[model samples]
Target: MKLIIGGAFQGKKEYAKQQFSLQEDQMRDGKEADFEELFRVPCLYHFHEWIQKGLKLGWDFDGITERLLQENPELILISNELGYGVVPMEAFDRTYRETTGRICTKIAAESQMVIRVVCGMGMVIKNA
Candidate 1:
């Protein structure tokens, strides 16, 4: 698996596409993808939004990263960095932010490659 992350509008998606030679249809938008689609899709963007939805729906995220790694070892995930700025006032907001960070951290540790995009440029932070 691989991870591409950056702040919103940082062109992570474009970079991932160009870097991997992926087409639009080959990537799935996490916001609307079915739960089962995650394991089947080659790439998934807007992953943070999908996590938020799962949290709101009381879905257990435990072992999900592991499942993805096992089921789709070649998957490329794109998520917006959400750990910056002031803390949120709402409890749910805080949970969502922290959950996304923790999950991304886990994914990064196991990913064969991890890239951070900024201003449409990709900086490879990790490469196996």
Candidate 2:
């Protein structure tokens, strides 16, 4: 599995398409997908939104993580880096940011490759 992260609109999707030779149809928009449907796609974009949905639905992080890992599919995940700027004032926003960071860390640890996209360029952060 591969993980790609960056700020919003930083071309993470484009980078994944180029790097993985994936078509737009092959990439699932996490915002529109449920947990069960996520594994069906080769790439998952807007992962932050998926996390938000899971949180709203009261899903446990460990459950989601385990389910994802158990699938063991070659997937490219795209998430916006929400922890780089000023801390959020709202309680929910703060939780979302922290949760996203933790989840990304867990996924990255299991991923074979991790890349950060900035201004349409992909910088490899990890390869195993």
Instruction: Report how far off residue 33 is in candidate 2 (Å).
Output: 0.8
lDDT of 1: 0.94
| TM-scores, one per candidate | 0.98, 0.94
Question: Any runs in candidate 2 off by more than 4 Å, and if so which?
Answer: none
Q: Model 1 residue 62 lDDT?
A: 91
**Worst lDDT 10-window in candidate 2:** 64-73
> For candidate 1, which ten residues in a row score worst on lDDT?
30-39
For each candidate, what is the lDDT? 0.94, 0.87
* lDDT digits (tens) for residues 53-123 of candidate 1: 88988878899889998999999999999999999999999999999999999999999999999999999
